[model samples]
Target: MRKLLFFVIIFGFSSSIQAQKYSKEVLDSMYSITQQTKLELTKPKSIKLMAVGDIMMGTNFPNDSYLPPEGKGPFDNVNVILTQADILFGNLEGTLTDEGENAKRCSDPSKCYSFRSPESYGKYLEETGFDVMSIANNHIGDFGAIGIKNTSKTLEKHNIAYAGIFAQPSTIFEKNGITYGFCAFAPNKDCIKIHNLTNAKKIVEELKQKADIVIVSFHGGAEGLKHTHVTRKTERFYGEDRGNVYKFAHTMIDAGADVIIGHGPHVSRAFEVYKNKFIAYSLGNFCTYSRFNLDGIKGYAPIAEIEIDLDGNFMKGKLHSAKQIDEVYPFIDEKKRALKEIKKLTQEDFPESKLIFDEDGSFTQQKE
Candidate 1:
């Protein structure tokens, strides 16, 4: 009986030890999971994105006269405003190739303009806080495949992400633990066509699956000051179909795009908030140097600084106005002409919008 009792006690003790071990393991696992959850909750959830339009600092195609001076940087005047954002974006209006044949056939040589910035000029964009560039514009193919290849190589070397051509339709990148997907569209050859909504939707939907936020850039609309307004209908510029920007923006948002930025008009346009997403119809001429026609409204360089949640909901935004004068680089406009133009255009185009604008250049969506 004593032996039996001793055996029973030993068995009970072993069973208790096993139970404790299992419980301890479960508790440890639960604790680890809880800690991981806490970390996730503490991770950064907001991103500041800054965007500008049409950045052709200078081109050496025709001659060296169109290029900026040796010691002076193109963005030196507005570097402070640009360097403040987490992601700085712009449309690269030209190629970054030193030597390539100009493929554009000009009926009138004087009317034809081909831009080919030197390869060294890419560093200036990088230094000026340009994180990504849209190589999906009319001028991207001026120098043919070699220009595209050289531009890609230079951007890669500078760690500046770029997309929009047939070869590189979209790009995925990470910043501050948030994954971002970016794609660009244009009506020009060799670029991802802006008129193809089906393809655009497919690209954006695929990006939404993998990225925390998706940004879509379209180079559409008619060019020059007369075409500054969003007409809501399909626009044709110089016999080319510039997609209906209104339809495109709404469609992209429906297809999981969080932000829509439009350019190619070479002038600022209205701002819109659709389904809680932000859209900038056009950002205007940002840093086009000598060869550009920076006359009056064409010189308005508005820097759009936007804040969005990790899910890419529009939070707030600010428009910093800069203007190009004397056919030189852009300088901060104390008159706030660009902001005023945006405000006026937004009011005229989207009067029913729920966005609240302040005199200080800040704007936000009205809380329902």
Candidate 2:
């Protein structure tokens, strides 16, 4: 009888310890220690995530001629690179509604752009291997609530997750035994506000508790050709507050975000490493078509591929240089324009950062 009782006691203790292994405090401590040590454990399980900036993929709301050729042919050049990643993300800069009056009123209808792609375009996103998209841009609500609802349904039908909308500000999914969470923010109607740091931190913290890895995407910063650098201060465009992207990224990192992706500047900015977390200030225009100016700096952007360990520690990244040719399709640039520009921007904007980018587009952190 005593032997059986001892065996029961041992089993109970072992189970209790196993249960406590994943408690909040324990996990926090483990992550902190791993980050501090900066240990590159041998053969640790990791996930590769690829992200890009604003993508319109051609719009055919008021006109059908703007749509790309019937099928997945539009993504022929970049689909392979996109599909290779475990998770592919991008910013969907327009609504996917077939019929809705545009809510945005521009002084000059000719210059003020509003994109409304047909619902069928969602299939293109799915075929291109876009797992998640951020609907937190200025153009998402071009057709108001109906536009938002239809866009959500279209993305759902295609089995693509989206964040930054009214109903779904964050999403969680599991891949290869790892749980990943994504949330997006923007200073636009019907989207999570990027300027609200308190709310942003709260949302990110809640997501961090629910998933092993958390990625935050924000659409902030001023726009156009001159707004290419990270000023590290609140930026304004046409007297509108665009939020301080630098402060926002650092705060999100401190709040347990594993990766921070920024866009909306329409130009690529610098990269930074904070607390062993990776942050790309702005990815610029990825695959915009028509209604967008693709001149000089605005045309160059990077297809950022980042790898992180199971614990969400920064590992390495590669920037695939791409450019929007003829203001339409995005093609791989042989000149490595985006990579070289990012390297220069990173050095200029974040001179003290520990992250380093090589000529071949590969990136690593400075060893302690």
Give all candidates' CA lDDT scores.
Answer: 0.91, 0.87
Clashes in model 1: which pairs? none
> How far is 265's C-alpha from truth in model 1 (Å)?
0.5
Tens digits of lDDT, candidate 2, 69-178: 65445567777688898889999999988878878777765555788888887888988888889999899998888999999999999988889977998999776556
- Mark the 10 consecutive residues where model 2 has the least summed lDDT: 35-44
The CA lDDT at 214 in model 2 is 94
TM-score of 2: 0.86
The alpha-carbon lDDT assigned to residue 61 of candidate 1 equals 67
Write out the backbone clash pairs for model 2: none
lDDT of 1 by residue, 54-76 (tens): 98988876677778788989888
Worst 10 residues of 1 by lDDT: 103-112
